[model samples]
Target: MELPIDHFRLLGVSPATDGQTVLRTLQQRLDRAPDQGFTHETLQARADLLRNSADLLSDDRHRTAYEAELTALSAEGEGGQSAIPALEIPNSKEVGGLLLLLEAGQAQEAFEKASRGLQPPQAPALGSSREADLALLAGLACQGAAEDYRQQRRYEAAARVLQQGLQLLQRMGQQPEQRRRLDLALEALLPYRVLDLLSRDLSASLERNEGLQLLEQLVRRRGGLEGESDAAFPASEFQPFFKQIRQFLTAQEQVDLFSRWAEAGSPLADFLASIALTASGFAQRKPERLQAAYGRLAGSGQAGVEPFLACQLLLLGQIEPAQALFEQGADPALRQWANEQGEEPLAGLCAYCRDWLEREVLPGFRDIEADPDLEAWFADRDVQAYVEQQDRKRARSAPLHPPEAAAGAGAGTPSTQSSLDAMPLWPGDPLASGLAAPSQPGQSGALSEPLQPEEDEDDWPDLALGWPNLHWQDLQLAERWAQLRTSAAELLAQPPSWVLPLAVAVTLGGVGVGGWLALRPKPERGQPIPVLPAPDGTVQTGAKPSPAATGAPKAAASPGAGAPGAPAPTPAPPAPRNLPLTVAKPSSAQLRSLLEAWLAAKAAVLAGATPEHPLEQLARSALVGNVESQRRENASRGESETVTAEVRDFSVTSQTPQRIEAEVTLRYSDARKDANGKLIASTPEGERRNTYVFARDGQTWHLAAFRASR
Candidate 1:
């Protein structure tokens, strides 16, 4: 068995290598190789493999595995070399047949046949170096094609070819040039459209200047900045791109062309944020010098500078008018930042003010309740909805373009399959529409047809459940909870009507509520006692009134103290010094009347017949408990709501009158996930509990304060 040094060596180093080094080395080696019919194309292909492998090494884990393979191959020596396979080319006719299929716009069929019919490995030629070189070359070609496809906006096609490329490159030794090409391709294709789309979806209140700033950055990265030849694609062809961006610009766009020499770093233009501030300043100062400031800011590419200006406006509390100017400012990037912050560029400044309130301002008011309305204003749903609607409107107006056209028309070029094998051609911008445009007379037929993937919508890929997957789990839990609610409602309604009455009677037979003395049929021995409700949730009897039943202001006896039927205490409290003289003793008939009134109130409240009774408080408290538990369940699964609590001071004289104040807090949590199942490292998580505390106000308990922190 011949040792496969090429295979072992390919797997030994990083996937990326210096492209020039790999290309020159392969050319020299190919020149010395025996003329067993190896062509220059074969050598070129092997060099591509090295480059492709080098690119793969960028991913740490893949690099590690590949390196390990090299170690294993080197250690196995001859025995391991036997495992190396040889590859054979298909018949010329078969290759031609596949090429024809590809030219006919049947990419899927051509790929399938080519993959199935390809030859397996054989013993290495010249210690298997030739075989290894061939494998590496094939890999590089596939990788290069994949990348090219991606650049042309043929994502699906790119993915397919890239998979093939990766497999091939794994077998071939790492080539340097191929890796560089792949990197370039990936960089070119990485979608910047997401920023544009997301920005357009933000609130209208965001300064146009902000949006313009963002668009400028995006355009600059793509080499589309001002003074750069915007002429690469005719203005007519790129009208949609310009239109999509124009929303961020105010009517004050400078049609006046001023030539500026290109230099390194960010392009100098007045950022959108500054433009917004200038507009706002003009609105306020209405000064003759406004134009110069506006012009200066609009031409500079410094995005960060405008926020400082916006902050100055915010500090003067010129919020609404300043916001209007900002909203109309020309900068998409600035707009995106403002949109995310839920305000204009001065949001950080405003936040500083809010922080002061919590850190500085609030300390002074610790004893006094903060106004609840202030917090509620921020949670206004209508404002959020309006902003979302504005964003959608902007996106709807953006232009949609098709990906690049296919190759293989009478341009004197070979069929698409051959070209692909040589240098992969990509679908242009138009192809991204998922509907490739019909080929023009001189265009390639492969670019003419549209593709419809066959996979079902219900088919979800398997994924590893990591911390990042928690958001998904939260969603799943919510769906489950909804289903559970439906089933529970159905079950609750299924029972016979009379059954509820019987069940309630049995469960509540011994339970007591209010005065315990009312529940007791007769006085037991010498002391009076109150009845306690059943531990299990159920209906209960009301407690009795004291012997002095006038209902005037009375100091109630300590509960559970020296009462009949209670656990005996070895020690007792000091005896009462003065018994009340001429106290109105309660009559049996009066006691019966009071008990009847209490029962009636409880019954009416539970039936939802009326309110404004003592029993209503008890009912509301129970409802709170139920809702609290549900919220806890939801929190565990990673769903929450944004809530704010308000504290109020109240003095209610009705029913057990007491003067008091309390706090109320509300909160919510929503599930979130990243595009990939990786940790959404950007999102922050915190406590999910919401609490409301009430203090006594005269005879009643009123909410004093509420709080929610996430």
Candidate 2:
């Protein structure tokens, strides 16, 4: 009744049509046919094609049986046979085998079986009773193969499988049920295909705008930016897509893309754009644009947008809002992004924020004891408070005195001639007595005026001179004179007898003794002592005297000690006392000179001068341990290397009478040979402050030790 139907011809496919081709061709024909008013022959042809095509395409065993049957029918047709039996589809058990393979995760095996089953037969016409069921089974097997590829992250292969299924379904145009399933599978795979293309060649995709279009489609399919449709696809799925294409997009393009997605109200789009903005070098240099995009996303109250926005705000120096966002809690994803982005300026900004919080905000919070919220906030970073307290303790412990006071205390008044002159002549002598002498009345001295006035003379005696004026009465004076005359008469009579002669004899004897002593030969002269040279090279012909003898009182010489023609021998001056070495505190000018000379000597050593050089001589004379160390270091460096040092400035940190601790800033340049002996020119410019301890050697200052400071 169906006329020897050629299923392939009816479905517009060749005899060798693959199973997918048969399914596609049959579906197309059915879809093209009207639902109503179709002639019986046309309807019958469509029905017969659906049945035979499903039978041939649904399973390999059924398709083989049908093909053999078709061959027999064809042979019968040549013989002019009138009958053609209905196509027999494989039993459920045969179809179940393919489904079992797919269900057991054996997708490749399932796909192979499905492919064989869908193969077109030699005869063009075939019919089956259960066409819809077989077609659906074939679609399921194709989806299974595609799913296997996807699970292995072989997106390209998965996409290929999905595309093949799509094309097959498209060709079988009228099979709505099978076509819909294939369409959904293909739609699901499109993003991965785009992602694969992007990963392979980002520049090509961007140039072609394929990546952008796919991203838009993905965003739209997720029910616009605002919708939660993205929950269906893992964030990891789109991560590769964004990461691959981020560098290729220009700033404006990124902004436009982000702005469009943001307008679509998709939180995922906003979040991704925020990440891209943070990752971009341009965004680091220009944060305001990023801020606007972030502001829009954050306004939407998205779960992840706040922290990213906070980071951007931090980079922009917007501390308050950034702090608020961070206080809510740090986002691990954003922190990871910040680290991997490798944007130094952004990293620096984060460090600045951390420092600011620790140094400024946290302290303010800690200081507010009355506010529980502030206290609780401070408690989170209590270590910071402890550090602050320690720092404050250090500051308090080493309170800085005024510079003037410290200098004044260290440097007493300078010795002067006036001060020497003002000293007392003897120990415990009063200063006023040594400075000025008391004068007699009517004499020119420090105090020449009389003690009493002329009018007060009668009240007080004139005792200015050694003797005082006697105020005896006239009668008393006469009585005393008469008594004195009487006494003188008595004395004149009794005296001058033995006493005068005794006095004369004693004077004569003293003169005789003196004459004898003077005439006596001096003690036998000892052998002339050998002379020894003084430290200063002066010879002294005398025995080394005891300290007491050398300090003994000198005697007065006799009148005739030396005869007219002979000269008196003079004792050699006592040998000068040996004084111990003492350290002398240098003045400001002397310190400057010492520092300048030390610097010059260092420069000389660095410049490759020999130890015999003038600067080296000066260094040896002025600097001790440090100079020798430097000289040794320089000598060890050999001739191929050269170092030059320039003193910038210096300050005295501390000073003692014996040593000075000074901080000196110096700029050094070094030139040396590499491992291959090739001369490498390198000039590293920076300031170094070294603390040098200078010990005073006599009147000169010598560098004793030196160390670098922070």
The best candidate by lDDT is: 2
Q: Estimated TM-score per prediction?
A: 0.21, 0.27
lDDT of 1 by residue, 1-710 (tens): 12112321432332355445445544554354323243454445444444444454545676567667756755676664544422222342333333323333344444444444434544244334444444434444455456455556565466556556544444443444554565455433333332233234435435334444444554555454333444444434333454344333332332111111122322322332233333333333322223334334434433333333332333322244234444544255334323322222344234322322222121211012232121232233442233223222221222111122223233553333211011101123342223434543543223223433232223423312212332433343344334323322332211111000010111111221111112112311112221221111222235433211211111111212232453332232233222111113322222222222322343233223452335323222333343345345535655432211111111211111211111111111123233343333221221122222232322333222222211
Q: Locate the minimum summed-lDDT window of 10 residues in model 2.
A: 497-506
TM-score of 2: 0.27
- Candidate 2 residue-wise lDDT, 329-399, digit = tens: 34442243223212232332243233222221212110121211212222233322332332222222221
Clashes of each: 91, 21
**Model 2: residue 585 alpha-carbon error in angstroms:** 27
